[model samples]
Target: MLKKIYPLVFFISLYSYAQTSVNFTDNFSGIESVLYNPANIADSFYKVDINILSSSTTTGNTYSTVKPLTILKDNKFGLNDLDVFKKISSLDATIDTIFKISKLKDLDSYVSKKEFSEDSNFYGNSTILGPSFLWTVNNYNTVGFTTAIRFNGYAYNFNSELYNQFTEKTYLNNPKKLLDNNFGNLTGYGQAFAWYEVGFTYAGVPIHTPTEFFKVGVSLKFLRGIKTYSFLLNDFTSNFSLNEDVPEDSVLDFNGSVSVSSSDTGANYGQGLDIGIVYEKRNKTLPINNIDKHGNIYYSKAPYSFKISASITDIGFISFNNIKTQTNNVDLNLANSNFAISDYLSIGSNKNQKETYLLPTTGHLNFDYNLNNHWYLNTNLDVYLFSKDRINAMKTVSNISFTPRYESQHISAFLPLSINNFGIYKAGFGIKTGLFYAGSSSVLTNLTNLSKEGDFFIGLKIPIYNSKVVSEYKKGIRKYSLLKIIENIDEEENTDSEL
Candidate 1:
């Protein structure tokens, strides 16, 4: 039976290696998951906006091989255990079936036996920085520009002992021998991903008034991305039982450990598009006929007006090259004659042979109402439609996020209202609901355990100006007359004579 299984195990291992190479699409969409829309650049004033978001979920199971595989029976005839056999058989069948059903047997022919057991726990955290600017080109037109950078990093551990114990013949069905193999130890894997984009937008107001205006805008963006992966496997010293069949409780201990690391990097480039609209209305007065103070009809100023806008960003996509590497520590007894140390020390294959897909574009909506000179309210909603790359990477899992905000501004002092005035000041307090994504939290979830799902923001806005103020004295001096000039000259002559 052992000899019969050896050939099957060899083929299984080879097939696993071919399929286990990390797919670039799996890591490329992390940043694209956060963009709501590209048009946000057109609606923003020349101000910097920074938002921090986080979320997490207990939906996925932890990595554990011991719990999933248990001994049902043990015998002297090669130590029989039905449960472990079933589990290993199921894994092998699943991989083979996928290849056969997909007609990918020829494609998977290149896989090696070691690649078949590349199981590791997957997890990570991400951050995004977005900055935008809008400049008015004329009374009826404006141009906007924005740039965003997204970074993602993750750490994972592979259960190498479990894998080796199940595949190697020497450790079959003996808990003591399995323990001697150091099967539960952890091996680390990690990757860093960065995505950046720069966009340009043009907006114009077809209709404008003292109190209201309507504007529309569109933008084009350039995108660039980079990714790096690192794999580390710790070495170990093993103890073996002289007996072919060992008891479940027999003691076996580890004497030492070893470690090896490998890394690889890849890069790609692409482009996208954005569009948006803005509406603004200010204070207005209504006509009224009535008797007021001192028997005169008086009118009062109207309440402050409202502003609303929406935009869609990253409405496009890009393609890039893929790079991959692997490293591991294998027992000298189990290492195949064909295995080279260099293969376990560095990236050996699949370089410049693959292409990865990026995440989909995003959309955003914003609204604000000014109640009066001293108080105001503001809010925003953002949506991320999962991209094709994300769906493919996650095996077709769908993901989305929604974010909202509210704010209030107060003015402690007021400047006199006049034409061409230059100085203004204001301060405010703001509270925003925590970010919420469909089926999970935002990419920031790993950094914060914020169960409440919201954040509080506080900020200030101030304006300073340089301008000419027309006063009564300056106006009168400008209206110089001949008689005034002669009077000033006579007064000077009298003063000189007296001196």
Candidate 2:
């Protein structure tokens, strides 16, 4: 009965996610820079960074589609909007599209044109960094603290029928193909939840020599899980007929866990850790008296030509107590039936034991080059270390970005060109002036009506030092690759790293 009438039931309130601050890759990165690499706190130019307020949101999917017309006159408008179901179903476009697709398989494959499963996954994170601080304790060390509300969610391994149908738009014509068992097996699972987290970090440039320099950083975090829902399918198979005369029997081997707690009742706590290392080349022969290498005593702020860094972060788990779990087996045989689905699986007996949930641990790789005094290019790659098949697991983010920027004492701007592992191609711009920064991951998508996926971020920061000139501003990016320029610089006997 649930399968016969599922088309009329519009599940508009599902799907959510957000990513890290991809735009904070410049001289004015401020306090939030530690979110990427804790060691950055030691390398940044600012003596101190006080974060005022910062927030981010992201929503995108591969299985379903949302008609992108704004809902006005008492309708919910955004991804996190409260009254999602009513607002989503109110649009005529949404209703017609739903009716035409007419089945679960067709509905699942409504968005993409080809290479279906490659994009039929899920990801989302929402973070609000509040009252964060990063202070340079000395010329070579830095300490920082941050608190934020973070939510993560993901879905993957959907049915192959949708992939076959949507690959050619045949699902739209023959809705029965959406029900054909010959289409292949079905397996999909997803989970979403929110948590509160607080973190402390220490980073420093602890080692220096004639040939190399090294920086190390570590962070510790505390987390409190608020709520969670894990939807799963272990060998699940179902079949239903659109024709009333042809009765159908669908069976499923499913299990699920859902837990909830208000602010007053939520007491689940856990810990996470992050460690990073950085390596850079040092000025071998040419050195300045009080600046480069000569007059250095306790701590000297010397510059390096190139650097590479790596970190494994978020190694921890949250423990939710007083939870329940179930193994559900359903056998639905119906003839000429159409009824609304109130609920399918019931919760098991209350289990007071504590259940642990792991954080979506991440691996980071970074590269920075000083092309010239004022010109630089930075690259960062963020990867999730876990597989999506795990229940209640956070999906990994696979994105590689290159940012080129011009920097001055109080102002800077950059362009980020990114190619995401999930086939999302986007470009965005960011600018920082003294105490603030703003940017979006996909600027052009936010402006157009056909936009499918988008995200925006903004933050405020206060730099401690107010110097008239940016530190060790490089000259040009082209000189690093040109052999003639290096030869000319050697002929001139200029040992300024680049020249």
Candidate 3:
């Protein structure tokens, strides 16, 4: 059933632009570790953080100019020119009737009559809203967990115009001919994706020295995505009426119309893993200045600490259920014989078909250093690896996102600070480059493009305790009550013994 509707679905997919930037702020998979180190979370019980990002880009145009009907015509006729008899074979009678008035003598006429005036000056903007929570176990051994939800949405619109011009004499000779089909309107292509993940990490192994730490974490995620496309056509007319060659009564004039709509909802599921390690020299001796009141030398020592850690994140796959639908009219004769459109323009046929595919899995690597608890800096690199078909199948139509699955990478460095005892703040900058693997795969091939780089992120973190905090507080209360009871009993015993 899906095979019958694949072509229509494929056409819709072609119009969608699914490529998005993977900058420092856009790294949802790394949020847990970046906001709360395992040791910190374990000591504090848990941490909560939220990050928001906005980015924009103007890209160059890169679409081939070929009329839809021309391609179909060539495939059907197997003819190089209109002069060949085979060129008209199997053409629908309605289309053939319109073709009879044309002065188009060859394939070149049809090709040249339409201009490929597509420009790449494409503009896109995106915003990401993310919130996460990380929990810790205890001081000696810390178990941390985090759940982050990220929302990413963006839109791309194009200014495309199609015009046809023919000699006035040709219009006079064939009054039924179309001289101009100039039509232009806004074409909408937008995407929205929501990523929700819950992850847990265990750090500060009891067996490790006081200064050394290691952690491992895993995340299970639920991904929901919604994409919409709006395509409008306008300003279509026949040249015969404009030429005034045919009698008013004999002229057949046609007005242009357009169809605008949205596609189906997209949803998926994904999972990932993250692991980290931190080693610190908590007891370092520094040569101290020797000073005496009268210039005599007395040596004193100072303490120093240094720490380093690394982590990997977002290492899993997202599976997609092919919940595809079309908002425009489907030509039953071309694909499915049973396809029919109701009065409301709803597809009443083949409603039970569903397709399934996989979205690309993305990953990241991070390294950080803490200098004496007052200052810290970290660097992160991320990559997206997938095939072309895998990406295309998941995209909405009218999207011009040309990101193909190859291998794209990004890097950033930031400085984080502890605010009092309850909060932490960080600000940093980064860059992204390469277009190895980006977006859905069906539209393009193994293609590579110039890399793009961008800025860093600014974020804050606060503690949010898990069950451990309540448990610890309860334990303290119980101990205090027990101590009071023992005291009372001792007092009673003393009085009785004294009596």
Candidate 4:
């Protein structure tokens, strides 16, 4: 059973620096841009944006695009599939060659030899929804609200000792070297949850003169842990018989602080907020005036400026009550009530209970330089605040990127060159026609046979631009109300008579 499972479950923890939607980082026109940095709301071009439906997916795993196991078998089956359980477990030389990339290499004794690499992670399978809203009420103010359902999984710290035992069917190596002190800490947790966010933002006349401006924005989010399953391991120790030919008193022995479960029976709740600020230098070479809905004109202060922004996001946690957590309790849950493993050892018995999960906190910094009228250059940086040591954390591996874009009031295109969180170079592209924008963060993984990781984001919305606010009334029309219009007409006649 373990041998069969090693093939499927191992791939789950293979992604590092998961969220790589670089194109969305500097796309100020799209509502999704706020997800990258709340401060971006200050740069919004539209007065009102209503995102009807939007979605995005990001995924990664350790396996290369060419999967040997998938090619070797005609019918593919997952580890949990009933059909796969029916087959006999087997490992061949060819199979080993294909998966050799994940094998542990030489490392200092201070570090666990179980690690295939410093960054072996997995994340994704994400979806978002709702009619997210944004409003640029005036030249100095902009606000937005976004709602989304995030479902994802993440795992890390697969030590070499555990890796060899699961993948090996030939001769067992020394169990003491594989386990004992060598068993390093492996921690992972996954959840499928929904969050409703309401954001209020304000951006006014800037820091210095009209040529330079500053603004700040914040987002408040409420989280509901709809369904969740998590597993955690710390200071694990194991011992087993090296000789498979002879059956010993105990073939396998293990004890450690571990938590594993399928799902929780109770409800979960959480609250979090994001804060950001932006500064821009306006070109101010030409005066820009925009018409309001009421036939009035307002000045455009954000026209053709070099924008710089910085913000920290997702600084919050979720508390789950009565969660199905593995407790270090008295009773042991296993087959045959007559037998119990915890009776012999002092450890390994845990019950299901409540747990608090933390959100993935990130730091963002961006720079957007307008080159002439339509061409703009953008540089963005994202860094994960929490390292692997943090529990249930989804920090993005830090990366810096530069994107060149051609943007107009209604249409835009961008080509970005970036080094991903994992330090892999990515060449991606994006395009926007009217109120729709779509693109990938890393096109190499999707276009070629390298299935390491990829990110795609798409959104739809009806946006009200500042430049397009047109009124139905004629010039200088008193459209406030019927009485007000009549009073204004009478005042105009009186003023004409006095003149």
Best by TM-score: 2
TM-score of each: 0.40, 0.73, 0.37, 0.69
Which 10 consecutive residues of model 3 have the lowest summed lDDT?
417-426
lDDT of 2 by residue, 170-203 (tens): 6567666655433334456667768888999999
lDDT of 1 by residue, 1-499 (tens): 2122223333332222111100000001122212333322322222222223222211111221111001111121121456544544563455444334433333223221222233433333232334444553433555655556644333334453455565566656555455444444433433345567676666666654445656677777787875533334453444543334634334443332222222234557777777777676643322211233444221111222666767776566555566543333343332223545543333324445344444444456666565433244445544555532232121111222222222211112111111100011111121221121122221132122211111111211121111111122122223323334666899999999999
Of the pair 2 and 4, which is ahead by TM-score? Answer: 2
lDDT of 1 at 343: 38
Error at 369, model 4, angstroms:
1.8
Q: Which parts of model 3 have CA positions greater than 4 angstroms off?
A: 1-132, 144-148, 152-192, 195-207, 210-212, 222-312, 316-322, 327-360, 369-377, 387-389, 392-461, 464-499
Candidate 3 C-alpha error for residue 44, in Å: 6.8
Quote the lDDT for 406 in model 2.
79
Residue 304, model 1, lDDT: 24
Runs off by more than 4 Å, candidate 2: 1-23, 63-119, 163-184, 240-264, 282-303, 333-350, 444-453, 466-499
**What's the lDDT for candidate 1?**
0.36
- Candidate 1: where are CA atoms >4 Å away? 1-133, 146-148, 152-192, 209-212, 228-267, 281-304, 325-348, 387-499
Question: What is the model-wide C-alpha lDDT for candidate 2?
Answer: 0.60
Q: For model 4, where is the 10-residue window of minimal lDDT?
A: 104-113
